[model samples]
Target chain A: MGMARAIEMAKEFGIGMVSIKHSNHFGMSAWLVQQAIDEGMMSLVFTNSSPALPVWGGRSKLMGVSPIACGAPAGDERPFILDMAPSIAARGKIDKAIRQGEKIPTDWALDSEGNMTDNPASALEGVMLPMGGPKGSALSIMMDVFSGVLSGSAYAGHVTNPYDPSKAADVGHFLVAIKPDLFMSLEDFKARMDYLYQRVVSCDKMGGVDRIYYPGEIEQIMRDERMKTGIPFTRGEIDALNEEAKLVGADTLNV
Target chain B: MGMARAIEMAKEFGIGMVSIKHSNHFGMSAWLVQQAIDEGMMSLVFTNSSPALPVWGGRSKLMGVSPIACGAPAGDERPFILDMAPSIAARGKIDKAIRQGEKIPTDWALDSEGNMTDNPASALEGVMLPMGGPKGSALSIMMDVFSGVLSGSAYAGHVTNPYDPSKAADVGHFLVAIKPDLFMSLEDFKARMDYLYQRVVSCDKMGGVDRIYYPGEIEQIMRDERMKTGIPFTRGEIDALNEEAKLVGADTLNV
Candidate 1:
């Protein structure tokens, strides 16, 4: 539904806009953010799920592999989007590595015994490491609090896995959209953002470094490149997606 | 100066109420945040300085030993404070390690040649590592954009060293304070925050983990413990502080 219409419906419920609770896993955070950006407002979205990582110095899984995405509209360019999981490597990354028969990077994950592992399968059975040790763990905890606790939804460890269709996973998602005119002129903010982007991109490079890319720069570049070259999907991922689509009586993409 | 008075003066300059730029290195990010918190406003502060680390995958130095702090008041309890640097270990931690004749933790620092080192002196001559590699580096870059670029102040390598007395560093600081009432009631936000905090604290503990801690919990505990037991300072640190105090015609603390 259009965000405006959704907001109107939320008003009928006597709440500030609508907050989604127990949402099924969204494909990619950026995709959801783009939906909100299409309406010309700043968007912030968060998701919380089962504990897949431990706090610093602890061996047990205690926090979700939370993710956050923020997007803002620009005048002539694509929206400035930032999407990241609080972990060093998301579980999906590990799965991709496994499919490619590649070794996972060291220290990115730990085995069931809490020992570091490079085998993707072992890493999957283990816990994904937080992005910056304790700091990242703290961020993950905060995301859970904001997305789950504050939203009055399911929290870490209790959340269901979207891949497992047999059981319901009470997933929680929090979203906040602000009209650009709420704080400053949208034109001014866009101009400043553009100028800042240029300055950062034009910065002096360190040794052997050829480019300085901003947060969403590479993704934008990738989208353009993929549009021409076509999206690359592994054989397994293609088969799985196709099978799911077929079950739903939907046509699958040729790619 | 009182925070309210300072903010009023800032407003007189045709800027926001809490404009901060080129402020002398405040003692601690938390201290300055507390000042803003006392004024019944949410606070965000950022500081930039000399190169302490390299970007992920690059061996050469590029960014400063920057830090960011944010604080929001909660009812009845101490404020919610989050203060951290993007580096694996702050420069102050290295200094403390050296004074105590202890080896620095692995991965925290690098020698002059860009190889990892445990010697604090070598680490001092070299560079500190960003936490969790690229994620921390990204955050460091974000700090630059938010604090330096947004405020039209010095960034990264251009920021001066606050410790150096011979040359003025032209260091930059960014402070932002927002009245909660502008967006939501203070009481409502605090109550939500308290609920979030309680849920996280009440979660099941991982093996060998005794208790969970919110962002500012440990610091508050430390402050209380130190108040009763007194802070311990090395003889050399005490001597250096005393000499510096005398040079400024100020009395040294009695320990």
Candidate 2:
């Protein structure tokens, strides 16, 4: 992915943004931004993928559940991080509900007939709706423009799916990295960030609630827990990854 | 406000951002971003306001229905714009619904006791819910960080309502502008944008749908139509505008 190179360029040249045109799916945008923040850089990233959500108020799927991610460092434990897709619910989440034989909320998706549905199976066959309706749809379009159109990458329906054997994915990404020291002292900036995090989390809580978290707080906790527990993988996953590595003549991941 | 100045700075340089603190409530952010794009610059704006929404699963009203706005020129007709608050429903809309004696949606707000309610009066007395649970709550926090915290402005519960006569609204705003020419050719960028827009709106429509609009399309239509037929105002609105104008030693408009 271009994120690593973009981080390097920003550190060297103060501010650098890269628009990656032709690439495979880049795993979680949070991971990429946190990578930059670890090196004392503030980062914003946008990426477009295959269409999943329909345009707000429209029936046809026209936009990706594109992600918007941003992060910066703090003086304390967790960094300020935000990573979210435009959709109200991701298809992966719907799939999980279906696998567990659960009904979904009515807001999650529109059935194939373009009417709201609560059935998980119908939702899976239908289109996922964007968060906040038109607003999220617009955000998805902007992400696509920044990552795909601006970068001379695939745009709209032209973008392919990597999971489909006949398609090439053709994902596009846009990254903006800023050196924290360029605007203010890195130490001071970090201190200010920590102050903000503290203020937000220390606020009065609701009854029956014992914990408050900033955007990145829970994700950081889960990532840590998973690290301690070790990542789980199916046998098929390991074999598939190893086979791809073999084709590329590279050392394979243990998976 | 800072949006205009940020746009100027971004055009002079390549990229420029401004964070303003201790400010009055800036009007709808859509207007600000549209202003920038009209001058051929891409813009993003974040503004924090009085607390109106609670943290995702929390009972306390500790966060504002902060708005996020962004826009970029698309060919020659209109800019692609997105402007939204983090709440599932805006107070203004809820107020209108209450005035019309309509029942609100259950998911839109919590009752005073933190139970979901469809009663408009109870919803108004309580707090609005976030658009997509945790995602909207996180976005709201990010807006506060960018506008209020980074700018050394009032944040969270400290941000007061301008409408409350006894309190001063120490609102804050963050603006970012980028010169289109700095990234790529303006014409080419616009062309690509037109291409993307065309692809999206032209996609096959779902049943009973005749059109698909990109973000800002409806706004653009209304603006043009209102331009042909002058903007309408209620008698009270006209009197209020005149009174505010008189306080600033400005001429009164003939309505």
Candidate number achieving the greatest TM-score relative to the actual structure? 2
DockQ of all predictions against the true structure, Cα-based:
0.18, 0.48
In model 2, the clashing pairs are none
- TM-score, chain A, per candidate? 0.77, 0.84
lDDT string, candidate 1, A86-143, tens digits? 7876678998999999998766787777677889998888778777766777767656
Per model, how much of the real contact set is kept?
0.11, 0.41
Specify the poorest-scoring 10-residue window by lDDT in model 1 chain B: B10-19
Where does model 1 exceed 4 Å of error?
Answer: A1-27, A31-47, A71-80, A92-107, A113-123, A155-160, A163-212, A234-255, B1-27, B32-51, B57-60, B71-80, B91-124, B164-212, B241-255
User: Over the stretch B178-255, how does candidate 2's per-residue lDDT look in tens digits?
Assistant: 776655689988987887778778766655678888777888899999999988899999999999999999999887
- On the 0 to 100 scale, the lDDT of residue A1 in model 2 is 48
TM-score, per-candidate, Cα-based: 0.70, 0.86
Best by DockQ: 2
